[model samples]
Target: MDLRALTLLAGANSSGKSSVMQPLLLLKQTLHEDRYDPGPLKLDGPNVVFTDAGQFISQVAVGQRPRFEVSLGVGKDRGRLLYEPSAAGVTLSETGVSVGQAPEIIMRDGSVVSARETAVLLELPGLEAEGKNSIASRHGIAHEIPLVPWVSIAVVDGVLLKGSVEFPAVGWKTHLSNDLMRLIHLGGHRGNPSRRYPRSVSSSDLRPGVFHEQAAGVIAHWKQHDPASLDALQSAMRTVGLGWSIEPVDLDATAIDLRIGRTRETSRAARDLVSIADVGFGVSQSLPVLVALIDAKPGQLVYIEQPEIHLHPRAQVGVADLIVEASRRGARVVIETHSEIILTRIQYHVAKGTLPPKDVLVHWFACDPKTGDTTVTAVEPDAAGAFGDWPVDFAEVGERVDREYIEAAWKRQSGEAG
Candidate 1:
C-alpha cells in the first residue's frame, strides 16, 4: 500500500490529537522487541519523556503503563514483516511463522537466532509452540506491518507526523544531511525577520547545519531533472516565502560540502538574511518543518509536530499544501495539527479533486482532566475539509450561545426583563 503524504490528523485542544503522535514517534520504541537495543536516545523505553506545550506527557505513566494498539494494511508482503521486542533482542516474523514458535530473533549476542526451544529462551511466553502467529505481545500488537510503502513516524513537541520515507530505516541518518541544520539554526523556526547573530559574521561566513543540509538535498533533487521532486521542494519553501540556492565548498579539507545560499525573498535566503527569533513566530516555527519535508527522499518517512504553530491562517494553508505535495511524490506524510486553517486546507484540496479524500483522517481526542481518561474519535472529511457532520460540541459555539440566550429567556419569562 502506497501511503499518501497528504494525510491530516486534526482535533480540538487536549483532544488527544497530539497524543496520536506518541505512538508514531515512538514506533521503534514501542513495536520493536525488547532486545532491540533502542539506541542511546532510548526513545523506545518505558521511561521515554516527551514535552508538548510545556506539559509533560511521558510514555511511562506513574502506577500505570499507557497501552495502545496500531493497525495498518498488509500490502504485497501479506503482513509478514513484524517487530516485537522481548527480554531478548528484536524479533522478526513472516506470515508463515507461528507466534508460538521461536521468532527469527535478532539477539543482543549480535547473532540472529531461530529455533523452537530458543523461543522460550527469549522470554516470549505468548508463543505457544504451535499456534498461529499473533501480533500481540507484552506491548501493543499490530494487526499488520507491511513493506513497499515505507512507513516511519516522528513526534515533535506534541504533534505526530506519520509518513513513509524514501530511504530505508538506515538511510534516514544520512538523508537528513548536514547542510539542512545550518539553515534551521540561522533562524529557520526562530521566526526572526533579519539575521542577528549571537556573534557577528558576514552571510558568506555562515556554515551549513541541519537547515543547510535539508536545503542542499532539495537543491540536489532539483538538479536531478525530477520535476515532481523539485516541485514539491520549491512549493514548500515558496509557501513560507523563502529562497533557495546551493554552492559547493570544502569541508575539513577532505570533501566538498553542498553550501546552501539564502535570499530572504526565497525561503533559504531569508534564513541567512534574518534571525529566526526576529521573524514572525509562525515563520520561526514552520519553515524548518517545511524544509524537512521538502528534503525528505521519496521512500523515507518524516515525523513533524505542529507544523501549524505560530503560522498565520494563510501560511497554515500553505503548510497543508506542502504536505500534500510531498505525499503525491510517493512520500508518506502524517501530521498532527490543531489548526483549523490547516485542516481546512486539507479539505479544500480533497474537495477540489486535487487530492484523495481517503488518504487523510482526522482523530479527535478528548481527555477528561479529572480522570485522565482519553477517547479518540476518528473524523472523516469531505473534499472541503468539512466533516461529514460536526458532532455536538465539536466546536461548541452553539452551546455557549444557548446558555446565554436561555438565561435571558428565563428572566424575561419571569417578568424580570428590565
Candidate 2:
C-alpha cells in the first residue's frame, strides 16, 4: 500500500538478492543520462540487451526538422521526452542518439521546444526508427527512470531490503552509502568497539574533537524525543521486558551517556552506568539503530538489516513493536529478518489490532541447496494462524537438528526394549 516504505525482497544468501538491487540502482542513473552503452551499464553484463526498436521509436519526438522526443513509462508515471533544435548537433541522452544541429521537433504538448531535458527525452528508445544510431544497431535502446536505488543490510546474517528512496528530480538512493558514510565520517565514534564495557570512564569513550558537530546531532536527538521522566523510561523498559532502568545524561556537547541502575539502594535513584559493550549484544546493536530511526524525518526510508540478532525472544517481539511505532510516526522501515519470534510477535500485534495487518506483510525466503536457488513466498497468516507455504527448507540447520533428535529417540526406545 505505502509502496515507498517497507517492502521485503526476501531470498536466502546468494539467491539473487543483490542481483535485484543492483539493476534498480542502474535504472536510477539512466533517468539523468540517456541510454548508455552496455559496456558502461553497471547492472548487467556487456552482452545483455535491454530494449528493442519499437520501444525506441515511441521515445522519439516528432516535431520541427531537427528536434527529437522520447516517451516511456515507469510504475504509474509515463515519462515524456523532449529535445530542442540547437546550432551544435542536438543529442538525446536516453538513447545516446543524436540528430544534426538545429532540427526543430514538435513536443508531446504540441508546443515547439528545445533544450537538454528534451535531449534526454528524445534519447529514450521506446521505439526507434531503423538506422537510428550506431549504438542502437549494437545495443538496443533502454527506457525507464530509476526511482530509488535498492540497498540491502543484514537481517540477521542475510540481506534485507531496509527501504528504498526515489532519485532526485527523482532523488538519490541514499539509504546505504549515505548513511554508512555518516557513521564513518563521524570519525572516532568508538563506543567500546572491543565488545567490553568498562566499570568507569575509559579510553574508548574519549572521542577526538573532529566529531564535535556530528556528535552534537546525535545528542540532540536523544534529548529531544527520549522520555524526560526516568520513571517513564523505566516503565517503557519494563514493557519491553528489559530489567534495566535507563536514564539519559548529557556527557558533553556531542554525547549522551546512558546510565542504567546498578545497586539496589542507589539503583532506586541512581541510574546504572554502562560501558556500551558490557550490555547484551541485542541492546547495543538495536539501540543505536533505533535512535537513528527516531531521528530520521518523515519521507526518509530506513533500511535496516536483521534487527533481531542476539535479542531474546521477548526482545525480538519488542523490536517488532518498535518498528510499528516508527512506521506510525511516519518513518518508513524496510527490514530483513529471519527470527520466527519476531515474525510471531508481528502477527500477534496485528491480530490484536495493535497494528494493522494490511499495512505489513512478511515475505519468507526458503533456499533449496539442491537447485542452488531460493524461493520467495508471502508469509501472511490465514484464519487458521498458519503461514500459507511453509517451505520444508526454511531453516536447513533446524531441520537437521530435528532429524537428529528423532533418530536419537528411536535408538533409545530400541535399547530400552533389549
- Measured over all alpha carbons after superposition, the RMSD of each candidate to the real structure, in angstroms, is 12.3, 14.5
TM-scores for every candidate against the unseen true structure: 0.51, 0.50
Best of the candidates, lDDT: 1
Model 1 misplaced regions, further than 4 Å: 1-5, 28-36, 39-41, 44-235, 242-281, 297-299, 383-385, 392-418
Clashes of 2: 45
Q: Which parts of model 2 are misplaced by more than 4 Å?
A: 1-6, 17-220, 224-236, 241-243, 248-251, 254-256, 262-271, 292-298, 366-387, 390-407, 413-418
Instruction: Give the Cα lDDT of each candidate.
Output: 0.44, 0.41
Could you tally the backbone clashes for each prediction?
73, 45
| Candidate 1 lDDT over residue span 1-418, tens digit each | 2334554555557666545544333443332223543321234243134422123233555776332333333222111223333233323222121122333322212112334423332354332332223212222222222211111221110111222212123222222221121211212133343232122112331223223223433444345545665566555655655434333233343223343335535554634543343444554455557656665555445555577766666667777777777777766666766666666677788888877777776666667788767776666666565677654253466567889999989988889645
